[model samples]
Target: MKTCFIVCPIGNEGSETRKNSDTVLKHIIQPVCQELHFQVIRVDQIYGTDRIDNTIYEHLKTADLIIADMSEYNPNAFYEIGYRHALGKPLIPIMKEGTDIPFDLASLRTITYATDNLDKASAAKERLAETINSFDFSIEQNEKENEPVHQNITPYLLKIQDEIEDLKGIMLKRNDEFAKQTVELAIEQIQKNTAAPENKFAEILMKEIANDPKKFKEFDAIFKNLS
Candidate 1:
């Protein structure tokens, strides 16, 4: 079964914030997820000896769906939401009605709920269900490819890498050409200044280069790795 990871604030137990979270989980999220056959997992439900933060990160990356509650302006929740967005995965952002969404995330379609009113809670649940149902979660479909990171930043980074590779190749070729020309010029100058037999100095220098290939290889390597 597909998993839906919940990213939300978990205030201290028995506090009003905690009670609101419980109601949303029990009434707003779990019911709809259950009907859709999604296995819902939350940070509080996680159990094991593993570091909790690491475990939460793994879920944020690998979960098939994510429902991030923006209520309370919780820093942790917002950070996780940012992390999830960077992965270009499915994310459903929700918040309590009247809560102001940050400007950066104002463009996202966030489901607003009012747990104090039964009718609004019911409506929010329906909206959440509809949003979940609208996603094309088939094995062959990737509905979350439209995330901003994937749409813009990933391609930009890849393009930069490609350009860097191309530049390295050009620099290496130019370095090799320059080295060859410099050696040829030096050989020409030596032969002219020394009164050696015609082309004799060139032949001796070429023979020395052939015999000590490692020296030329080291020289080339130094240039290759420059910057």
Candidate 2:
């Protein structure tokens, strides 16, 4: 799960750029990134809770790639791009149709597309995906290859990230299991006392859960407190 440090201006809901950004995210960025196995993180998603400067810098230093939106010639976006460049991180610079690329960065690779056209946005996504796939990571790999300290710790950090994703999936599965068990438990409790006729399907479900209570253990702690 490689990280993509997204540098863009987060505008209010009514702003045109915000609308455009949403289009870019849905039609361009998300689909392409999902294919490349990159987790997208932007300042809006994880910033301001900490010292703003430090939070952005930490992500810039660690993310595997940066996809910078230079759409507005935004000072903050450029500042982040400068910091990323200084760290020698890989980046893909993208901008709206009319935005200027800085003279100094004129020689660097960039993607420019129409924000007003969904068709063009889709085309640009394929181009951006191709550009990302073609990037040479040999420089970063070679440097890590020579460092014994980095070789050991880098793997540890990656494993921790992988485990975090796994735990998220496990937590979701348990939550779903608990909800199903609670529904069955409620059905059983009602059937135990109420004069109302049981729904045959629900009775079958309660019987199934009773026969396999171990699978319903996630609800035990919460259900135990009930009368």
Candidate 3:
């Protein structure tokens, strides 16, 4: 069966946004894939992380196409989608109504639907199914044959699989350290000022930083001092 990557958000049960998005995705997306004999691989279900992990990269390398929901402009979602675009993979970018499509992706084709209404979701699903059915794998093969060799990046792509694994290991350890320090700092701050809101704010900020390493480095000095 042909494989497709389905990128979307997954969070705790309390997260209404993720819940609603998953509901529509399972209801509309999976049925279409079944009919077309395509396998649907949801990144979250496979990797158990919101960000693109090594498993996700491996899946993308094999996927015939990617169906990405950019409804929330989620940072990780955008990152994964961008990676797919870089690989020249066929992509279907979809969003909920009223969400501003990012400027960088504005030139590409996309589908917008109203998640609040089932009718709109159904219409969008039908359109996407038709689009998927119309894909010609022969074109993909021909394009690959006609593509020029990129000597510079070809070596990097060859090593990317191993590099990504090493990076994930480093990131997991770094995030653990950050989380431990964050909790200690929050407790210390609370002890200094029993009624202060700073600790609560710090907790929120630290959680965000733990989720994204790029932001963590921005406050490297602070974290170093805390160490």
Candidate 4:
């Protein structure tokens, strides 16, 4: 099935932007996507401790289209949208009227609407759906035409690199200390666990560590000690 990734806020319901986005997703976006033969996947639904980032990354990589609500400039939403941009996927950027888009994305096309009016929101949804269905909306073509002259690293990759770099720094900082010995043990355990043939839990834990630098470092000593 053709899939579309929809990015919006999750836990915070007090924000007007979040409420309007929820309405658009439930009342308009979902139905229109269904009619257009597209499966709508929301970011908020994919939560938990195990493989969440990996799952979300896989979805973004494979989705036919992405609809990002930048009204609140949510961090996760921004990260997902940026990843889509790097993957050269078809993306529909929407925001509440009067909000200024970041300068970096100002050149890209975006749809803005006033959320207070139900009519405006509905019209915006219809227009967005129509835009997605149009034959001229080719993500591959757009990416090729606007391709950067130099190689640009994706935010996802950059994040992973940053985490690895942080780990390296932590190792250096702990060198010649008792903490170093502790970290060495944790790494040994992690390697064994990751090397195991059927340790899905261990794999999940590794991915979680890869995603969060602070958490990974705090427990790095303990994890390394494991066998």
Candidate 5:
């Protein structure tokens, strides 16, 4: 199933920031994403022992789509948005009306709504759904035109580029599966009543390694050697 990673400002519980974010999630983002069959993953909703930053990066790399809330000029939200942009992935940026978006993203398309106004929020949700719908249309268009053409060398290079992207996606999915299995096994061991303190430390170490691709690769190599 396709996933939509949400990059938004999640403040302390009961705070105004959290309340506003929750309102947007419940009233706007979640419903639209669900209708489109996109499994939404929010940072706060993620449980378990994984390092949050690493998990964010993993999702940023792999999620089929991204929805970013630009309210409050939140640095973390913008940072994640930037990271997704850097990856050259699709991201839908949304904001509350009157929120000052940073100069860099000022020119990008942003869906704005008034949190306190029902009509405006509903309209925003419609626009958001349309934007996401376009993604499916674009993918279909790409697929239709994916036939090899004998036109020029440029087409050949483009083919190579597409192949590279496909390979990268496959590698990312496999890595996620491997990481998930490793984490599950480690959790099972850690939950054992007789597990030692050293096992607890190992669990922490595993979480760190799982977060960093380079570290994870090194760990994988060592594990293979031991096996």
Candidate 6:
């Protein structure tokens, strides 16, 4: 069966936002997916494993379809969505009305609803169901053929790690123990930050560093949260 991965911030216990998220899953997304024969997958639904683990990359890469909730402006959701977009797959962006849609993604279609308004939620659900029914998967499958399929996520991340090390090596020489920083410690911090408690900016910043090691100003900007 096809899988529909729900990418949203799992709220703390008893939080109103989480309660609202559960409502969307139960009344809006779940029923629609059930009728469409898609197995609904959510981070909270995973049992006996660290929910905040890097395995989220697996869901982003492999899910047949993805629905990302933009409410609360969750950074991890956006980060995971970025990888999904890079994979060239089908994604449905949804949000509660009044939530900010980032300018970069403003051009794409999105479903918006007033989470507190039952009528609006119901209408949004109906439209989303139709959208799911009419979705075209052929384009996504064609793109997926060009992307490498990884059975293990570690090796794929190791490639990123190598890039990180290469970037750090250059930085280390320029400031040999500048501020008493070492490449090993820097990588350890990056990996630890990326893995747990879900600090999305660190993950993105690390990727930016790996992508362009020579850009000191760029790293400075990320450090200052300027970009």
TM-score of each: 0.62, 0.58, 0.57, 0.54, 0.59, 0.59
Tell me the spans in candidate 2 whose CA falls farther than 4 Å from its real position.
137-227
The 0-to-1 C-alpha lDDT of every candidate, in the order given, reads 0.74, 0.66, 0.65, 0.64, 0.70, 0.69
**TM-score for model 4?**
0.54
lDDT tens digits, residue span 90-182, model 1: 688899999987898765667889988999999888878877775666644243545433322322222233333444465457676534544
lDDT of 5: 0.70
| Candidates in descending lDDT order | 1, 5, 6, 2, 3, 4
Worst 10 residues of 3 by lDDT: 149-158
Model 5 misplaced regions, further than 4 Å: 137-227
Model 5, span 1-227: residue lDDT tens? 67999998889999998998888888898899899888999989999798989999989877888899988878888889987776555677888898876788754567788878989888888878867765542342121223421212222222233333433454456675554454445444544634542465367557777687577775576457436
Displacement of the residue 82 alpha carbon in candidate 1, Å: 0.2
Model 6 is weakest, by summed lDDT over 10 consecutive residues, at 149-158
Winning model by lDDT: 1
C-alpha RMSD for every candidate: 21.8, 20.0, 19.1, 18.6, 22.1, 16.5
Q: How well is each residue in 1-227 modelled by candidate 4, as lDDT tens digits?
A: 67888876665777765577777788767877898888898766767676778888877777777888888778988898888878666677777778888887764556666657878777777767756764333434333445622222232222233334445467566553433443444455444644432243345457656776565676665447542
Model 5 clash pairs? none
TM-score of 6: 0.59
- Tens-digit per-residue lDDT, 83-196, candidate 6: 787776767788888887888666445677776788988877876776676555443364445674322233234334544565566665555342124345546765775563
Model 3 agreement with the true structure over 100-207: per-residue lDDT tens digits: 889997756566677678898887777677667545644443225345222222222212322333333554566766544554554455445443434364665677
Q: Which parts of model 3 have CA positions greater than 4 angstroms off?
A: 47-52, 139-227
Clashes of each: 0, 0, 0, 7, 0, 0
Which candidate tops TM-score?
A: 1
RMSD of 5: 22.1
